[model samples]
Target: MIRRINDIVAKHIQGNLITYFFVILFFMTGISSGAFMSKALTDFQNKELIVYLKNFFSIVDSKAINNLAILKQSLLNNFQTGIIIWILGVTVIGIPLILLIIGLRGFIIGFTVGFFVKQMGFKGVIFSLVSILPQNILIVPCTVFIGVLGISFSLMLIKNKTRKNTRYSIVNQFFLYSTIIAMIHIIIVVGCLIEAYISPFFIKYISTYM
Candidate 1:
């Protein structure tokens, strides 16, 4: 079972390598954009965010776990939304549209992380990880699957890859990809639930010094 699971993961990693690179590239681009944007808006938003954080910390004597939970839940929600958007993009405008959407989402993430990191220093990294990483664990896989599936489908459409068999191969691939995406969605939902209900307290505790 272990070997089988490893093989599956390895296949996924190989198949989705391009998508992964795209995600990373998009993230870096977004970070750059966000840095510039943050410089303009930091004066206002930073103070506001800090004030809010202070107030939040002040109120909760024991909110560490609760804070982490909230952060986790937010991440999960964001991931699920991304997946839904990807599916919609594929259904409405096909693979090109789906890739576009995924790329835009990646950029947004990068921008947000970059902005925060620039503004907050090391603390920003912690904040970003807490805010983004939980759901991202689920999201990266789903996005890769979506991207790979989109590219595969687009090629099939363009090349008439299955003219003789009516493209059953492509259809089968789509079904498999959709199934995997759905499973990822379920995992994200579960993670969100745990984060929302349990993470806040832990977060509050850890962030006290920050």
Candidate 2:
């Protein structure tokens, strides 16, 4: 399994190795900054963090866990993210923007997880697992995959546009590319459903009883 995962990753990152490496570095940097920021909080700030988390979790009544509004919001939010990547992915101009957006997304994940872990201790770790891990586990990989495709497509576009004898027609290639991106959007929707419908249920149970 480990070797299979390595092979899969190696294949995805193969052509765009340097691009992915720099993207991963940016993500790790964000994660480190978030962890350090947690450690640097003043005592009062730490207390405030605890209070904020409590309020965040407690805002909705227990019954609201399955609320349709919440699900709609979650789905829309993730949908927007996926769409952003999809649209930007088609243009050579969007390469740097895509990388920056990915970096920012990672930063947010790191900051939220780091802050929660710091405030709640072991429970923070548990909460992070239940609340953060499930959907993000899906979304993160999707983002990475999208980035790889975007970079690859952009490079292909540049080569095709500049080359004297282009091997593949741009129009046909784009139709197939777009079809795959649509499938990605469908996957993002699934991730959103899991985040909205499933993650909260586990978290509520864990926080209350465990």
Candidate 3:
């Protein structure tokens, strides 16, 4: 089973190497930009962020987090992102938007980690690991995959548009695209559950000691 899965992943990667390369490069560029932005924060803004982080830690230590609320919000945010990417895949003109979404996700993550580490050093790194890393482990990959697929699909549509008679059935291609995206949605759901349920416990525990 593991080998089968590995083979499947390898084949997919081989098929989309160029797309993945561009998508990943774009994501990394966003991350770099976000990290730069974090460093560019004014002293007042830095202090404000520090205060906010401390307040958040206090809340976690006090066990005041509403898990259900977190879950609902996480689901809403993740699902909306997924749906947008899925829709954009179908709209060839939305290629830029799809890349922007992916880049924005990377930027957010980069800023968060950059700010944490820059302000708090090692402790901040530990805090980020517990609080931010869990869900993002899945989320980051999902965003990248979605970007690659969206771009690839959009390119395919563009190619088809220029053709006198397309070789593949658009309906069948769309169904496959939709199906893959639906599976990604399931992964996103799991990631949200981890964010809402599992990460909190780790954050709460670390908050007390940190």
For TM-score, candidate 1 versus 2, the one ahead is 2
Worst 10 residues of 3 by lDDT: 162-171
Top candidate when judged by TM-score against the true structure: 3
lDDT of 1: 0.62
Give the per-residue lDDT of model 1 (tens digit) for 48-123. Answer: 9668766766766453345455656566655655566545534524655555566666666766777668656888
How well does candidate 1 match the true structure in TM-score terms?
0.68
Q: Write the per-residue lDDT of candidate 2 for residues 63-101, one digit (tens) a residue.
A: 456547767997777767667776776777877877777
lDDT of 2: 0.75
RMSD of 1: 4.1
List lDDT for all candidates, in order: 0.62, 0.75, 0.86
TM-score, structure 3 vs. true: 0.93
lDDT rank order: 3, 2, 1
lDDT by residue for model 3 over 1-210, one digit each (tens)?
Answer: 999988987998899999898888878888888888999999999999989988888777876779899999999998888888888988879888987888888788889889988998898899889889999899889878877888888888998987775655877888898888889888888899999999998888888876
